[model samples]
Target: MVWKIYMHMTSMLCLGVAAFFFGGLSLVSMSTGKCSLIEWELSSLNSLTVVFVLIFDWISMLFLSFVLLISSSVLYYSGSYMKGDKNFNRFMYLVLLFVFSMGMVILSPNLISILLGWDGLGLVSYALVIFYQNEKSANAGMLTVLSNRVGDVAILLSIGLMMSLGSWNFIFYLQDMVDEKWLLVKFLVMVSAMTKSAQIPFSAWLPAAMAAPTPVSALVHSSTLVTAGVYLMIRFSSALEGSKIQSMLLIISCLTMFMAGLGANFEYDLKKIIALSTLSQLGVMLSILSLGYPDLSFMHLLSHALFKALLFMCAGVVIHSVKGYQDIRYMGCLVEFMPLTVAYMTLSNLSLCGFPFLAGFYSKDTILEVAFMSMINFMSLILYIMATGLTVMYTMRLIFYSLSGNCNLTTLSNIADEDKIMSDSMSLLGLGAVFMGSVLSWLLFPECYMICMSMFMKNMVLMISFLGALIGYMLNMLSVSSKLSSLLYYKEVVMFGSMWFMPFLSTKNISEAYLVWGATNEVLNDKGWFEHLGSQGLYYTFSKIFMILSSLQMNSIKVFMKTFVVMLVVILLFFS
Candidate 1:
């Protein structure tokens, strides 16, 4: 009990600190006439509009507030959940580091600052994921780090390119770059974003990330790291506009959404299901953002962070109560066993599925509406239809399989209600899932639709999407398998087969040597005899040239060092 009080106080103090920093940022941003709290002066404005720094700064603050809220709640829950565990101190320290790094990621002014925070968050996440130090957890952490590093390379390259061609200052370069240069930069940025957001081919890591504890998964997936990509998209939307890359983004996002939705349906693991669903939802937001609805994307990201965090926490409660078992197949009749948890989970999932008056309804509908408005061709329309259908399919599956399915009373009978701290955390996040939209709509956009048709269209789409979800629920009740089953089955086969083949097929072997030899022979055959010999001679010449250049460079370095030493001796003698 004393430990619980101490943890609660510590979390509260962290929140207080975050609030102070955010408030200071707000004040500075308001004073600076910058659109975001962190300001850089630019000579040219191009198509980008300049607003008071309060706008972007407020967005950063909002994200920071979410970090504080969810991290604090997790810390509070951990007080009881991790009680007397040997690694409890280590866990708390990593958790605090995770929160701090995420806060920095959000509040960071320039790309350098953001990268610093981003890498810090990734490191902390890796540490937390492997906190248990089991083989599976360590492997998962390693894979997560490896995959994120691929994305980091692209980001680093983009930063270098931006610094070389544009200004090293983010806002200045962003505003000054012409469309062509901006397009190139945006392409690199998109690659980084897609990898970080867990879109399409890069998405496999997020489900693997579920090997972490539930609170860590919640923090990584919803509130902080995963959302970084969407934040980047919104932040750089102006540069992305009118680029061909937007079409590619739309296509990739639609495909990722559909694939993730299909994967979620086949997932029996509760956390994996939610993790895949989070990926799908993020894909939808990315698609919407690509369609030129930054505001809607921001709103959806915020709503998802709230509800998904709540759902994950509630899922944590269920897992904790059941002694760490997470398979939905083994979990049933939970409504009666843990009523508060069920209630919170139900509310959050409902919100996730876009039930009326819930947070998800407002954001999801906006995405669908934006898709409809922006889709200009038959191909795009088909993609949008597929994406929407997939969303309904997976969201309904998550709701039905986890919460509304037939009960397994025997297994559930052994479980008990969660402790008070855990319950409090769930209740707080769940209430936000239930009511954040209405409150934020008033506070952030009172005139809302009247001020922006785009915003209005987004909200209308969200409403219709909610109605679509209800229809999907009814369709699910009718006991008909959605036509997507075959596709999902095929995907499963491909995924399993690919995993089996990757480690073996990619290994260098006689077959690879034969293939390489055959390809080389074919190229040689295509060339005339003289040409082939000439090519070999050219390669030899280049090898010799490289050796000569390397030797010259080494000689120069040696000469320079000797000269420097001599000069240093003479200077020392003169001083003496």
Candidate 2:
């Protein structure tokens, strides 16, 4: 009880801090023309320097506030979610560690310091992922940590390279790279960001990380861990301007958006659906950032964070009520029993679908409009359209499967919103998901978006959204067993649903080959030839030599005595 109260106090304290920053910093931002905060020197040397930085521009301040706000709510929710665990204090400590890591990442502009935060996040996330200590959690935790380690290495390398620039702080070079060859630093930073955001090849771990606790998922997956990458890219957007990497990022991010949307359509797990949705939104953030629109990307990031966090919290409520059955097929007709949860889910899901006047609408529509305005290739444009449609498609499919059907679970009949703590947390985030988009847009962009585009282009997204909804609903309700059998039984649909065989590639395939090689090496080298030839062979060889010497020594003593007598006699004769 004392620990829970302490958790509450700590969370409230964080919220209060965020509130002060949010209130006071807004005025500071308005009054001061410059967004850069006062820098505190951590260390200084001729060629290596480090500084503690707090970028108080709207982006950093607002993002940190949102992070702390969500964190506070997550901490509050965890009090109820983790009520009676044996390692409850340990859990809280891990959470605080995760938050501290995120805070460090948010405030520091130094590449080395950011790496400090970056590695901390990966480490704490691994601990949190494996907190349950089950087989699934263990496997997921390994994947999460190992995959994130790639990013850690990337940032570490970048920090080493930045030493050439005489400072570890990246803020000094945000306006431009030091020189042309320093593009390597930009590329390295981008790679680091991609790993954190779970883009393309790095995406397998995000969904797998769903094995973590609900609060971890709600906080890490939604607001902090994934957004770190997007925020990094946003910070480095100027250095990336006109570099070929942005074009590549554009293509990769678009495909990631499409892949996640397609995967979500086939997924039935409730938390996974939200997780994949988070991935899709991450792609959107990256795609916009790649177009050199960091401010717009920041807007989308903030909006996506609110809705996605609420979506996960709502998912947590459902999962908790349903007694850990996460399959959507077992979660039918929950709307009637759990109206508040359903409402929260609906609002967030609608926001995800770009429902007008909702939080997702403002940023999402802006991104699409900006994409349309940019002189992008036909392929990227097509991908953007289809990815948007897929977002709606999967969301509609999720709603139909989980919320609209008859009661499918046999264990519990009367489900309702009785958990005050969980509901209260969701309520706060729900309010954010509803209003955050407009608020962030107004605060970030004083001038409204003014883009010139054709009517077909303008209406195209809405039409695609409608078609996606139609397809999603039909796909869920349609009785096509033969079709599904062909799709599900075949390797192809399974592959698509398994995120194009990513988990297989990252886990079993990689582990199996290494395990086989390890076994072979152990048996053939360590045990067989090398073992015999090394220690045993040498010992046996020395023993045989020693045995022969012993035999010679024993036999030669008699001969030696006889020779000695002969020599003595000859010596006597010679003397006479």
What is the TM-score of each predicted model, taking all chains together? Answer: 0.76, 0.87
Per-residue lDDT of candidate 2, residues 100-140 (tens digit) = 89878887777877888899999999999999999999999
Those runs of model 2 whose alpha carbons end farther than 4 Å from true positions after fitting are 35-46, 479-489, 512-576
Q: What's the true lDDT of residue 359 in model 1?
A: 90
Query: Model 1, residue 160: displacement in angstroms?
Result: 1.8
Go through the candidates in order and give each one's C-alpha lDDT: 0.71, 0.85
In candidate 1, which residue pairs clash? 34-52, 34-53, 35-52, 35-53, 36-53, 365-461, 365-462, 366-458, 366-462
What's the lDDT for residue 110 in model 1?
Answer: 63
CA RMSD of all predictions: 10.7, 7.1
Best by TM-score: 2
Q: What lDDT tens digits, residue by residue, belong to model 1 across residues 1-576? A: 576568656875677577567656645664564654544453445534322222256677766776677777777777777786777777777888878777766765466566777788678878877887789888778767766777777778877776654344455555555368567678877887887797766776677778787777877888787888888777777777778888889888877776776666556688987887798789888888888878788888888898998888888878777667787756665776678788888888778767779998777755565566654566766666665665666666656655666564444346666377788767778878988877666545545553334665555545545655776567555533446454557756566423322323323353478679888877767465546567876888899999977765886878778778999999999999
Residue pairs with colliding backbones in model 2 are: none
